[model samples]
Target: MPAIVGIAQVVSVGSSGVFHIGDVFTINPISTAKTFAGAGSFITGRGISVYNESSLTYTVDDEVMDQGINFNL
Candidate 1:
């Protein structure tokens, strides 16, 4: 189906965020965050080391029907 939005307002959209008003087949959002805190707060002194690693995979279908949209005054 479809929808008619008379008025739409979006104040803010942060990282990995989305704001939609019309029809959508799929909306996917992925995010990853890493934080390191030490005695010096992410400050490494002599004879110190840090290591970080991450892996991610995502997939989505490309088959979707046409969704109509209309706006009214």
Candidate 2:
């Protein structure tokens, strides 16, 4: 099967409905995610009870991989 590409939207200002660089996201449950800025892109992050703000932190999820979403990089 060819790799599937996904896309997300910038939901809010303080917190992103879809996580991106310089965005904050707190995950309570196991949820799938993708990149917001670029379609079929990816980022790295962890499941945290409370997501602290970062300059360019990304939430690592498996909504669409091979784009750049990977942990322990």
Candidate 3:
């Protein structure tokens, strides 16, 4: 058994990615991501003084994912 391809177009590919035309025995892909954010208000110093009052703001995130993929033929 065989395959015949006339035309093929590819846009983009990310990390740990693969592209094949003929055949493959085994394929494995892995990816990871991380993000951080901060929000606050401060008005104080050792040698400096602040006369104005400020509000406080806080933010938190608690979601994480660890995954993997494997393909074999």
Top model number, lDDT: 1
lDDT of 2 by residue, 1-73 (tens): 3454476566575432434444344534233454445322344567524343544445566655454323422
Q: What is the lDDT of candidate 2?
A: 0.44
Judging by TM-score, tell me the better candidate of 2 and 3. Answer: 3
Ranking by TM-score: 1, 3, 2
Residue lDDT tens for model 1, 26-49: 765555444434343456579876
lDDT tens per residue, model 3, 9-55: 98987665687786666665564454443232343466764454654
Candidates' TM-scores?
0.39, 0.15, 0.35
Model 3, position 60: C-alpha lDDT score: 52
* Better candidate number, 1 or 3, judged by lDDT: 1
| lDDT score for residue 67 of model 3 | 53
lDDT of 3: 0.54
lDDT of each: 0.58, 0.44, 0.54
Off by over 4 Å in 2: 1-5, 15-18, 21-73
What lDDT, from 0 to 1, does candidate 1 have?
0.58
